[model samples]
Target: MTMSITELEQALRALRLSGMSATMQARALQVAQHQMDFLEAFSWLVQDELDRRRSRLLDRRFTLSGLRERKDLKDFDWTYNARLPKREVLALGTLQFLDAKEDLLMIGPPGTGKSHCAKALALLAVQRGYTVLYREAHQLIEDLAEAR
Candidate 1:
């Protein structure tokens, strides 16, 4: 009562196991020739599915995030704005306040990295699998006014 590889592949495809079905032939060959265990081969196929799903999810998140460019919190230079509290800015990167349903305000004079920091935080939120909508201060105010 053994199933042929073609039958198994068809069954896997019918079950929507594209990742497993696509790699099944090569993986099965590896298992037979390299003495790889069934569990190991199965896990690799599962990992491929998981990785693909995760990447697609991340892409969707980025597209909906309204982020024009990727910003890195680590790239921020603390030396330029010595007066700015570095710890406070870095703490925002952790995004704990998001869980508590809190809002953050970044206020500073021009050329003080306020926008950079805000964008960096937005990037962090997006990377952490949170929905982010970024808008300029004036743009946000205008939207609010229109809503009124």
Candidate 2:
């Protein structure tokens, strides 16, 4: 037997597919408007669910990262930071270093945007599905020493 829309929505919710459940009604209209076939409509629903899950996972990672502040690469003041390696700094956003087992250390005197860059990269790593435990260098060393 075919399931009614309400039953289908309930089943989706029970399965924790809230994204599909919430968007199914609106997506159904899109399917009709676009004259989509069954497979096309189903694909749309699945894509929406996947995108929503990715967004939610990113948010959760950001929360768990314990970052003092949220920062974006685009928000950095490029104009004022002319001497800074803009290309190199922005390249960190690609997050290739983690894959290569590279650790980034930004050393500079205080007030040279060190904290800003560190926090921003940490945010990128978390958003890119990497588990990050953000801790100050001093704090991490202290913890390690105490553990020993």
Candidate 3:
């Protein structure tokens, strides 16, 4: 049945007079009327909106661990590789650089998986929910010149 404002006020008064606990008083308010139910539903909708916004901001701030696919890092043999020291340090540095919104440079001989490593790292950054852009160094410069 519909509950008028006056009825709601009476219920509230009764609840207070009866010394109902705060939790019970809140539940009583929720059950006061169909309108109260609508209000509660609207509040939940707003809360969901806020939560989504917060999640987006967090995603922008840090790479989410979920973004790194195992396949991406699979080809690299971490063991028995003489270059392990450099690549390992670079990987750790890449994570820190991503967090700080910094740049990374990978210079090495051809056929050394430079592009593959770059793509894997970029993908990792993407998994972390960070905004990422990737391009060959020459192509990026070309684009910049064209834009200018």
Ten-residue region with minimum lDDT total, candidate 3? 16-25
For model 1, the stretches where C-alpha displacement exceeds 4 angstroms are 1-29, 145-148
- How would you encode candidate 1's per-residue C-alpha lDDT over 1-148 as one tens digit per residue? 8999999989988987777787888888989997688899889989877776777887888788777878787898989989988898898888999988999988878999988899999988887889999988898999999999
Residue-level lDDT of model 3, residues 21-96, one tens digit each, is 2233444456565546755754654555456556666565434333333335666655634664655745653588
Backbone clashes per model, in order?
A: 0, 0, 3
lDDT of 1: 0.86
TM-score of 1: 0.77
Please rank every candidate by TM-score, starting with the best.
2, 1, 3
Model 1, C-alpha of 9: deviation from truth (Å): 8.1
lDDT of 2 by residue, 19-138 (tens): 899889887887779888778888989998999999999888888887968988778877765677888998888889999989988887776677788889999888777998888778
| Candidate 2 collision pairs | none
Q: Judged by TM-score, which candidate is best?
A: 2
